[model samples]
Target chain A: MVIDQIHDLQQVYRKVVHSMSRPGSISNLNNITEKLEDDLPCNHAFFLCALTVLDAEVTFHVVASEEKKARLIEILSSYNMSRIAPVDEADFILLLQDAPEYQMNQALLECKTGNLHDPQQSATWIIESGLLSNISALSLSGPGINGTQQLQTGIQQDFWQRRNDKVKEYPLGIDLVFADFSSQIACIPRTTAVTITEVV
Target chain B: MIAKPHFAFFDEGSKKEIRRATLKAVAIPGYQVPFASREMPIARGWGTGGLQLTLSLIGRNDVLKVIDQGADESVNAVSIKKLVQHTTGVSVTEKTQEADIIQSRHRIPEKALKEDQILVLQVPNPEPLRKVDAREYMTKRMHAEDDYSGAWLLLFEQIMKFGRMSTGASHPVYVNGRYVMTPSPIPRFDNPKMHQSKGLILLGAGREKKIFAVPPYTSVESLAFDDYPFTVESFEGKACKLCGSTDVFLDEIIDPDTGERTHQCNDTSYCMEQLNSEEKVEVENSYV
Candidate 1:
């Protein structure tokens, strides 16, 4: 069934806004994800998020296996009409569950972190990961967070470290959104200061 | 007689562009993210920025409140409310507590906002450096280098001229301890309310085509010297004439007939809420 673009996207966008504003907060996208037909190239929640923000005005890049990347790009472009740019120039970069650690790190390093004058020009990384949990090794404290918030994600520790290195300078960094198989999503914006509390 | 407009008035593409800008604005607290600001049916300078944000974010179930300088019934507020209601058919309210999204100009609601609610402020000027330096390119470079000496110099000049910082509204603030931002033209009294606010606050400048945000729980500090501190408008020994409340922000009024000066609550809805509750308590006491 085709989702109502106006209503459904509005709901999804609100959740995205909530997650972005309050880092480490998890937003459940099952209401919209459950309505999607099975067998999409990307996660349902990720697809909904892409649809909510992507259009002809922007560009995106997908980081996945050769075949999956092509299919995901084709589907995203056809649906949203956003151009498929290179990794460094893409406004939105998608990291599928199948992406290797090395590629994820490379994408993290190569993605645009926007200059100080116009930091908002940076890319947003939308990753399809394993299950998302509230309690994890990562502790976040920053603009959106009231105090310190504990969050756990299936993403590798190296990626988080690299993200920290990329965003060491204020106002110049990429934002992250992680969507798991359970239709749960969370975001860590550039303003958030993330620290790995546990090795595991 | 007029055909119904698209959902939220702007086309889906325009909404998507604005949403993208808004997301980026939220991600980088207080950073002015530029976007293609569309023309609305209303005039540009008159709350179009906040109206665009309200129209883009309003959902079918959301309760919207529009206030111009704290008056719910002001011409700008009422006109914008009617436009949104006519376009989306959503519910509108005067009570700040009942609003899911509050689009405001010049003032924040007197009551504390909840975490779920969002405040969209219309900004006449988004650039805090515009007054210090007129060149956009030079100001961009200054911001890129973390050089806000010009802003400080402007404040220092104010002190030299008036013996006190004479900024009445649109006071500059340091957000997340990085970028200096103008919290819309909100009075200095409302500037403190933006610090670590429970609700998300988004400021949009439609004419300027800029958007910025202060996410919930963020640190928003007004710029001030250690000795010359930032102070809000004092209302000591003053109370709202209508509600008899002393804590809230009050507007000075002059009696037209007697030429006597009085102070009253600027937030009409908040003052009305106080009055209604007092009446209820009085009724219950009489019965007892």
Candidate 2:
């Protein structure tokens, strides 16, 4: 579907900003049709985020199987016009919840955790999920959080542990955007202290 | 939400670019994210950074307030207010409490900002290490390595030279215990206002092509040695002549006739509000 590039992107960018600044706050991405095109590998929320943030200036990496990666890249490129780069060099990484945990971890490990001076140089991971039930509950406390907030993230426990491990280095980890199928989104910046809650 | 021709004097493309960078800045709180800073009608050093942020975030419903050094009537402030108003047609206000977005040159408002408000600071040099090392590459490397000893050393040297730490403005601060950032050119007195502030503080350096943020409820500590603690610009016995407020940051004005220097609160609106109140409004001390 043809969307209003300027207005749609502006609305999407505001949602991304809102979600990123306030961790675990759900915001919906606008301008997406109810029907999903067969060619696209994921939901329109991911595409909306990719379109708003990815430009000719930045490169993106899609983490999936070989077949899925190529298709996702094609779809992202068609929508955003971002350069497709290697996993380590990419500014943005798109990972699906169904993607193999090992592959996801490998791609995330390869992704740049920018050095102390330019932490912003690191990659932003956009993990997409189909359902809220698939996500794990996490207790979050950090800068943007008021006191302590409990959030259910569309990320695997193993991967979440690995990601949290990477941030123990502090100021040198990737920021995350958790995008759900219906376009509901939340963020977990690197500075946030996240703990996996035990399921009762 | 009206489809204005160009939202806030910038085309959608420019606003999108700024929005992208701003999101990154928020995600990586206190990390300076480089962006393609466009040339504004105003000069580079005089708050183009803050203007870019203000324009980008401004919506039809936003209430904007612009301040230079502290006064809303300053040339820089008035010019910015006019430019934003001319473009977005957003409502403008002089009161700090009423503004949704505040674009400031140097000083933060005297009253505490609310959670919904945003404070945009026009940063001259976003790099706190600039005073220590002139080379940008080395400074970047230093920041990458978390080697902020140079910043501390610079402070030490200042104490050595002045017999005490005498950084007047643009003092270095540590945000989220990560990056050492210049809290714009606000006087030392205003530095404490940033610590776990309710409002988000965005710092933009147009010439430097960098933007950083201190998100709401974040810890922002001004760098200081334990013995020689971080201190604000002192005005212990001084009170504003107009408002009679002693806690607020004061500006000393000299009379040409008698050559007598008298103090007045730097924040004009807050001072006026205080003066107009039937009962005295006390600003709680936030000093370290």
Number of the top candidate by DockQ?
A: 1
TM, every model: 0.98, 0.88
Tens-digit per-residue lDDT, A131-179, candidate 1: 8888968999998898998889878788888999999887889899888
Worst 10 residues of 1 chain B by lDDT: B135-144
Q: List the residue pairs that clash in candidate 2.
A: A117-B143, A117-B144
In the range B1-288, model 1's lDDT, one tens digit per residue, is: 978789889899988888989999999888888888899898888888888888889899999999999999989999999999988999999999899999999999999889999999999999999987898888888878889998899999999999888899999999988888999999999999999999999999999998999999999999999989999999999999989999889999998999999999999999999999999999999999
Clash pairs detected, candidate 1: none
Tell me the whole-model lDDT of each prediction, alpha carbons only.
0.91, 0.82
Docking class of 2: medium
TM-score for candidate 1, please give it.
Answer: 0.98
Highest TM-score, which number?
A: 1
**Chain A superposition TM-score per model:** 0.97, 0.90
- For model 2, the superposed segments whose C-alpha errors exceed 4 Å read A1-3, A28-41, A64-72, A130-136, B1-5, B279-288
